[model samples]
Target: MQMGIVRRSVGALLAVIVLLGAVPVGAAEKSAPRHSAQAIGKAERAMQEITAQAARETATAEMQDTRISSVMLHWTPYPAAVRYAVRVLRGSVGAPMKTIATMEYVYTTGLHLPLMAYGAVDDLYWTVQPLGYDGTPLAAASEPCPVREAEADPAAPALTTEYAAMPYAPLYPVYSWVPLAGQKEHEVEVYRREVGHDRYVHTLRGGEYDVYDDTPFTVPGTYVYRVRGVTAAGMPISNWSAYGSFTVAERTPIAALGDSITHGGGAITVPPSYQLYDWESYCTVPVKNLGRSGDTTEAMLERFERDVLPFAPRVLIIMGGVNDYRVGIYGAETVRNLAALREKCRAHGITPIFLTATPIRPALMTARMTINTPPSDWWAHRDYVNNWVMQQEHSIDVATVLSDADGELEEGYTTDGLHPDLTGKKYIGQTVDSYLRTHFAYASAEAERRVRMLKNMEKTS
Candidate 1:
């Protein structure tokens, strides 16, 4: 019976070979049948089914591995720590542990490691070291703690903008939040708090991580905003983030406008959201911060009409040009942009206060941020811009206080060589405060006069 079965299999194979040999090679090629659209569609659907099955299998495996591999590390917050350093280790049963990864700057107290990061390791541990503002170790490294897995859940967006203190909100407040994974879109809703209920004021949708609300809030009332993530199909993916509330007065008395320096924040990892890093926070005079991070002179000028007009500030402190000169933009062009900003302020009856651009320390900048290589003649351009600033009617020489004898940013005053740290910010804020204290009447008179004239125009219209 086995011999008979083998003979039959051989005979079938020979028949197939003979049948294939009978067809002329070129004829088979020429007569090949074209697939119908339906057939192609079926093939594509089948491929998609296979791909989706593979993805599902991969997701299931990942979920299982995540049960044992994902880790959320938390430690008591150290008093002097501006940031923390986290080190991950791997080890075997008998061998000693070896360092696998080191995160030099962690802004928050808790760090989450996903499955993909350490799924392959059977034994993993981590340690946290507190670091001061100057990157000095504030405390000894914590004992290595064994990584334990916890169930992972999708997180809602975390709001970054805050208006908790008095003199509540900026005119053109930037609403920003940390984005969530797999978030395709975001929905934002603004509500004005009324006597008995919250009234809906605005609703907007965008794909970006932040929305700069161009509409000026002129009313003296409290407003709240909440944001949530949405899927591409318009389905909600996350619950609404906690409402960020702010109160708006009739108008801001003084406002600062420029690039990152004016926006606040230093020590590299810390963001402008922290009041400690904001120069405005150190100033005795109440000044609203209208500054946005990463704004070039051109960008600042472009946003002046939309961002500044809303606040209707009496005095606008302008400190920019660092972002320009460092990127090799011609000094004359920056001056032109600044001049345009000045003209716009004057046209709108606002006092334009110019602040001299600070110098950069290329060596420290390179060490901390390799991508920020300033041009060889960056200082010359800075000098040119500062010279232009000094010629303006109202100017503050912040650069003079922050610069060393060699014209570079004083090493002690800065962390990244570009942005002035707390000490430098304090000096700048104090200088501005002193100047304002002496000239408050003049700035206020001019601003008030403009407000009256605009109101008169409105009545006539």
Candidate 2:
């Protein structure tokens, strides 16, 4: 009996050893395969080679923000490859000059872990300096590099993550819409701002959703949220989606009052011209953008009774001070100018909604580089008037407030800091919409009338 038991135990041990030996040696040893060491090293080196090739191919694609230009590259997609077409202009395109370099990448789907193939390239890598046509060295071009490989399996167990996307508009609150279909077992986290703090406000399990929507968040400020999807295999994809920011603003009527930003500046249809008032169409109430380019706040104040009062607008939106601040008006004087305009609106039983001044931009910065500071202290003056405006909110019934303190200036927002470019004006319209949704009672017919008026004004404008 003893011999039989020992023999059975030995047989079991031998079976286990054979099973372990059958697995791939490299997989078990946690190391590279010996026979293919040379080949693997070559592949690793090829990554750097491709990066170097990319630099040479895209030499002319490099540029700077100083020239008031944009980088427009063509995206041509094939089965598994993409090519970039480049066009760079230092000055006039009077004659077709030889482009600096063109770049492209090739991808394959076959065997042996497909590689980043390349096309023809120019020697654009500046580390090995090359002289230009005139023997003058052109600016050295920066080089591209390869992304590193992960040490561990991305789908490994024990990792957990979350992601979220929220839309934020300064001075206006927003309600988000999130869909839950395939993400049944994942954990969802929502971060919201109250007063000025962002704390974890809501959490839902995988099987449950729809617990967050149209849910009011904090006042006006930047809020971030995240959600994490976890698979049964314990893999986590917690990448946070882009931040969706929407400001919280008091609702007010669409005030049609101003100049160039209103009248549409330039020739009948050029940027920085009168076309800026196209946003009146998006307003909740009728707005007659009686703005004229080169019009000052004082000038606007002078004509408020004649131009704005006749419309019987429930709310008067006013965005000026760019011209005032540009001409050296600061602090209290700015307040007085804005206050006088507000008073005129109040006298005519119209509510005044103030659009806070946007920040001074870098391009505009150079013109005043010698002034110690930009001519427009709109940043400071705006705060002063806003403080006063907040106080008067009770006295004159100013309902909505629109501001751009948080929105980053992209090409569309402002060509310069003071004026709203085409897209910037439209963004202002969105901001105004958010403000009206919050502070006013839209259910009222009076409110509906205001909406109709805004629609007509938008059509005419």
Winner by lDDT: 1
- TM-score, prediction 2: 0.36
The runs of at least 3 residues in candidate 1 whose Cα sits more than 4 Å from the true structure, single-residue gaps closed, are: 1-82, 85-105, 109-129, 132-135, 139-162, 166-221, 226-239, 370-372, 441-461
* Best candidate according to TM-score: 1
**What TM-scores do the predictions have?**
0.60, 0.36
- Candidate 1 residue 65 C-alpha distance from true site, Å: 25
The per-residue C-alpha lDDT of model 1 at residue 92 equals 56
Candidate 2, residues 1-461: lDDT per residue as tens digits?
33444455456555555654576866745654563465445545654555454454344333221121111111111111111222221222244334333321111110011111221222111111222212333234222211112111121111111111111121111122121223334554556555557677565444212122323332323355444555665365444333433222223234455555554421111222112234554454434445555567787787766555544567667766555655666657767877998777778777777765443454543442333344434456645654665565632211122234442234234433444444555566666666766665452246556445434533453
Model 1 over residues 1-461: C-alpha lDDT tens digits?
A: 33444455456555555655576777666656753444446545655665565556666666564555345466654543668899888875456778888887666555655556666545777889989766799789887777653224335666766456423355556666655544658888999988789999997775635565656576766789988888777678878988887766556768888888887667765555446567876677777677777789999999887777777888889999999999999899999999999999989998899999988899888887755688999999999999999999999999987889999999988778888988888888889988887878666454445445444543453
Error of 2 at 135 (Å): 26
List the global CA lDDT of all models. Answer: 0.74, 0.41
- The list of candidate 2 runs beyond 4 A from truth reads 1-254, 265-277, 365-373, 376-378, 394-412, 441-461
